[model samples]
Target: MKAVLFANTDWYLYNFRRSLAMSLRRQGYDVLLISPPGPYGAKLRALGLRWEPLPMARRSLNPLREAALLWHLVRLLRREQPVLVHGFTIKCAVYGSLAARLAGVPARVNAVAGMGYVFTSSQMKARLLRPVVRGLLRLALGGRGARLILQNADDVALFQQAGLVDPQHIRLIRGSGVNCAQFALATRTRSADDERPRVLLACRLLWDKGLDEFVNAIRQLRLQGCSLHALLAGTPDPGNPATVPEATIRGWVAEGLVTWLGHVDDMAGLLASVDVVVLPSYREGLPRTLVEAAACGLPLITTDVPGCREVVTDDVDGLLVPKGNSEALAHAIRRVLEIPGLAQRLGEAARLKARTQFDEHIVIEHTLEVYAELCDPLAAPAESSP
Candidate 1:
C-alpha cells in the first residue's frame, strides 16, 4: 500500500507529522510526502521518506498563484497515483483534497488542524476570500469517498453549518495530542527573589492571536498595582498577516512590564518555571502550549473560545476570560495570583485531565485506522514481489 501526505508548509510536515509518516511506513505502507521545499526538506529525506517539493506559499491569497497551485497539485496527484491521500492544514485540505478527487484517488482524509484566519477575519478582503475557500471545501468534500478529520467540535460544527462536509464523514480527534512522557513535571522550588507571581504567554507573536490584548492586560494590571511579572515567548511569524511588529514588541520590553524571551526550544522547562501559562489566542484547534503546560502541572488562563475551552475546565484546570477583553484578562490574572492555593489545585486537575484524555497514542491509533480503511486489498505482499 502507498499513501501520499500533503501539506502547505514543509516545516509542519517535518516537525509535526513526521512521526505519523514513519509510523505508517512501519505498517508496511510506502509514504510519500508532498510539500514546498523548506528548511526541513533535507531532514525529511534523511528520515527515508520520499519528498516531492511543490511551489506552495503560505499566507499569500493571490488568486492566480492559488490557481497555479491547484493545477500543480493535480499534476502531482496524477503522477504519484497513490492508493490513498491525506492532507493537513486548511490550504492542503482544500486544494489537496480537490486535486486527489480530480486524480481519482480511492480515498482521502482532510485534517483540519485549526480554523485559522478565515474564521477570525472581518475585513472586506476576508469576507471575499471566505466564500471562495468554503466553496472549494464543498467541492473537495462533495464526493462519497472523502472524509473530514476535525480537531475540535466547534470546527466540525462550523463546517457542517457551512455545508462543507457531512456529519458522517467527520472524525473527531483531540488536537494533535502531546507526548506525556516528554513533558514531565518538575519541583516547584524557587528562591524568594524568583517567587514573584509570573504569567507566561507562549505562541507565535501575532496581533490577532491576542498578543495585543495580553500586553494591554499587563499594562492594566500594572496601573491597578497588581505587581506581577509577564513573560512572552515564541518568535514573530514574518509570513503571517497578524504577526506583532518587532518595534511594538521591543517597546513592551522597554516599558518594564513584560520580558520577551524570543523563541526557545525548552518549552516544558519554561512551563515548569512559570506560575501560570496564558494563551489569549482568538482561535485554536487546541493550543499545544496549553497542553504541554498542563502536562507539566501548571495552571492555565485562556480565552473562552472553542479550542481554548477544551483544554481548560473553567475554575477546575484553568481560568477562562472573555476573548479580546484586556480588563477581563487582567482580572483573571489577578484572581489566580491572589489565591495561592488556586494555582496548585488547578495544576493538579490539569495534569489529571491531560493523562486521562489527551494521550498521543489516541491520535496515532485513529490516524492509522483511517489509513487501514483506505488500504489496497489487492496489493502484493513483500514475499510476492517480483
Candidate 2:
C-alpha cells in the first residue's frame, strides 16, 4: 500500500519522521514524503526515499493562499491515490485531512503535536483566530476514517472536552520517540574536581518555551555564588511569532549567563557533555530535547506543566519545577548540582525511563499499529486508540 506523510517543514519530516518512512518502505509501503521546500528535502531524497516539495508557509494567515494550497493538495492526492495521508502539526493536519476528503482518500491521520500558538497564545490575534481554528479542527478531524494523535493526556482531555473529535478517535503517543542508541551515557564524566556542573537548555529560542525563565534561573543561581556553567543550544526561529530576538540572546551571552552553542549539528555529542538538560517550556505535545537528554543519562529539569511532566516525575526520574517561576527552577538546578550523588541517581533513572517509555523502536511499532488499524480503506476507522 502507498502512504503520504506531510508536514509544514521538510526539516520536521526529515529529522523527526524519517525513521517511520524508512520502516514503512521496509514493510512493503510506497511511502511518499511531502513538505514545504527546504535544504533537508535533498537529504531525504539521498536516502532513496521518494520526497517532493510542497508550497506553504508556517506563519502565513492569508485566506486565498491557504485555499490555493488546499486545492493543490487535493489535486496531488487525486493523482497519487494513496491509501492513507498522515499529517504532522496543526496547519498540515487541518489542510491535509480536508484535502484527503476532497480527493476521496480513505484514511487520514492528523497529529496535533501541541495546542500550538492558536490555542496557547494569549495575544489578541491568537484569541481571535481560536474559534475559527477550533471549528476547522472539528470539521476535519471528526469525519469518517480520521484519527487524532496527541502527545500527552492533557491535550487528549482538552480535545475531548472541547468536542473537537470523538473520544475513541484520540491516541496518546508519548512523543516522536527518542533514539536511545544515538543519544546515551557514553563519555559524560567528571575528569577534574574543578569542572563546573554544566546545564543545558536546547530548543528554538521562543518566549513561551520559557526561555526568559531559563535565563533568569541561571542569573539567580549566579547571585547565590554557585559555581555553574550554563549552555544554550539551538537557534532562534525566525518564522515563529514567539521567537526570541538575536540581540536578546547576545545580551545573555554578554552577561556571562550562558554559552550559546547555536544550531548544534551533533546533539548527541553535546548531550554527552552536559551534566543536566532543561526545557522550561510552558507547554508541549512533548519536548523532544528532554527525551534525548534522558537517553544521554543526564538529569532532567522542566516545568510541572502537561507535556513536561509526562517525561519527568517530580522526585522520581528527574526534577520538576513550577512554570514561569525562575526561583523554583534555579532551586531545582542547584539541588541537582549541590546534593552529592543526586545527579547520578537522577541520571540513572532518566536513562532507564527513556529506554522504556520513549525509545524510537517502541514508538515506531505503536505508530505502525495505528496505520495497520486503518490500512483497509474499505474497513471502518478503528474505534480504539493505539
Best by lDDT: 2
Residue pair clashes in candidate 1: none
Can you give the lDDT of residue 190 in candidate 2? 57
Q: Write the per-residue lDDT of candidate 1 for residues 195-215, one digit (tens) a residue.
A: 687799999898767898899
Q: How far does residue 321 in candidate 1 sit from its true spot (Å)? A: 0.9
TM-score of each: 0.92, 0.96
TM-score for predicted model 2 compared with the true structure: 0.96
Q: What are the per-residue Cα lDDT tens digits for candidate 2 across 1-386?
A: 78999998888888889999999999999999999999999999999999988878889889899888999999999999999999999888899999999998889998888898888898999999999999999888976588899999999999999999999988888899878988884576553764897889999899989999999999999999999899999889887889999999999999999999998878898888778898999999988999999898888999999899999998788998988999999999999998999988998898999999999898899888888778854534453535
TM-score of 1: 0.92
Error of model 2, residue 241, in angstroms: 0.7
RMSD of each: 2.8, 3.4
Report the poorest 10 consecutive residues by lDDT, candidate 1: 374-383
Query: All models: lDDT?
Result: 0.83, 0.90
lDDT of 1 at 303: 94
Separately for all candidates shown, the number of backbone clashes (residues 3 or more apart, or on different chains) is 0, 0
